[model samples]
Target: MRRLLWLTAAALLAAGCSAAPGGEAAADKQPAPRPLGGVLHHTAAEAAALHRAEEREVRECMASRGFEYSAVPVGDGVRRRAAGNPYGLLTRAVAAQDGYGLTVERLQRHPADPNAQRVSALAEGDRRGWEAALKGTRDGPREEIELPDGPTVSVPTDACATVARRALYGASWDRDRYTVHSLADTIVRETLGHTLVRAAEREWAACMRDEGYRYEHRKDPLEELEKRLDTAGSDPAALRTNGREELRIAVRDAACQVEAGLAEQVSRAQEQVEKALPPARTSRLEEFRAAREGALRRAGARAASTT
Candidate 1:
């Protein structure tokens, strides 16, 4: 999927550059911002609702096949799994305390689903059959959907995931929007890799050094903390020490970012990319929004009907 999207973006940029004035050099100079908070095909609430509807379908599908199942509510944990500072703006409060949230334990741990445990207790052959029914075969037949002027992507149609998606988004909805969202993500990644952003990162690194920390990039502090945690292993004392050092470094990193104006520079570059996207890409974005809204409405209706 990643390779295909990159190829699509590359093709679009190549075509766009040849037709535009000054070619690739001028196009590279243009500012392109990645979507703020990442490209969400569905909002958290919408996704959660869709998941609930899907879970219900899975339960019914299993029961009809002579197996019991339970529907679990997809709540905060599922929705906020990818929550992070996508905009490069880290608040002082967040940095001073959480420090990338490596040390902080999750407050809402997901309890084991009883239905899964019940499934596990079944006879080996029956359990395998139930699992296959719910998840479909790993090497099963697949349905391929192609993007407009892009590569074709395949997905399993005989799984619970597909059932839920079809109920909420209708057939081919995933394929239609996949390219649009993936292309937007590629633009953001390219924007971050811009020379101007790299220069700003150097300035940020310099500020971190002045604060008595040697780091090359904005993500270095968290990366260092992750390494330390891995080395600490099961040692509580070492973990605590590492956690404290991480908080201190994180606070300094956020302060340095402000002093060096790194966030502002990155944001500016992103805005340029957002403004410079070709009309076709922009149209796809609009289509993405409409598809999302329509899916949400359909998902809501399905959920309400089940109740």
Candidate 2:
């Protein structure tokens, strides 16, 4: 069955960056922006503000449509609970302990969801209607978005969530809205293609070979580990064996990343990529940033009013 929009496992991570589930801000003051590689990221406070504003808009829209919608507030611990670097840029010591960090992710406990409880309490027919209201009819109008590195996905155009997203970001937002949240593979592609970065990567590969691991690309280690893990599923003995091997490979991979200067070169390549972005792409990114800031302001105002 099509689950309710913004419910399920996603709620644990989506519920908060700095605010609890209601319209209230978790922190009184907004936090500064964070950096991802060279890109600017919203601080937890800013994320919570935007989420608080978006969810409130969703709730109001649902109420107008004669449905009960609960606003899932961003909890301060949402992203904080997850351990390990998603990018796999681990230090030698940490890598020796956590491996590709997938083990920690596998064992991470999920938080409770009020929305799930709400949905569970509803009649089957009512649940379907509720999902359709919040997420739109399955066969309804959808806007197709092409991700930089992923398959195209269709987003409901007229759902309460869509309405809220447009209200917060801008009616003109579609692709830009996706770029704000999804991976921008465009930059990664360009960065990796840089002559210097490629050379550094070759060196990293050689370093790996020297350490008794042969991989042509940086992602190979995790991909290989994941296949072994898939085969080891639900088998304690196999998992333990794999886990031990993973730590050894991870430690070497991480040390090689630093020793080969791949990390440094990638940083340099990213800076170059950021500077050399085509005017059109640069314009789009700037527009997205403006939309983000505009929503943050609205969120701030919304939080202030509730207080």
Please give each candidate's TM-score: 0.72, 0.68
- Regions more than 4 Å wrong, model 2: 1-53, 71-88, 91-98, 111-113, 120-125, 138-154, 179-183, 235-245, 272-276, 300-307
lDDT per prediction? Answer: 0.63, 0.66
- Per-residue CA lDDT of model 2 for 190-261, tens digit only, reads 767888778988998999999888899988988898888789886756666666677668766766776676
- Roughly what TM-score does model 1 have, to 2 decimal places? 0.72
lDDT of 1 by residue, 1-307 (tens): 3233223333433442244334323323433223733446345676687777767777777777676788876654543333344545554445544556665432234656767778878999998888877777878867887665557878777766576666666665666567676666666676688776788889889988988888887777777878887888756567666666765676566656666666667777777777777776555565566666777777789878868
- Highest lDDT model number: 2
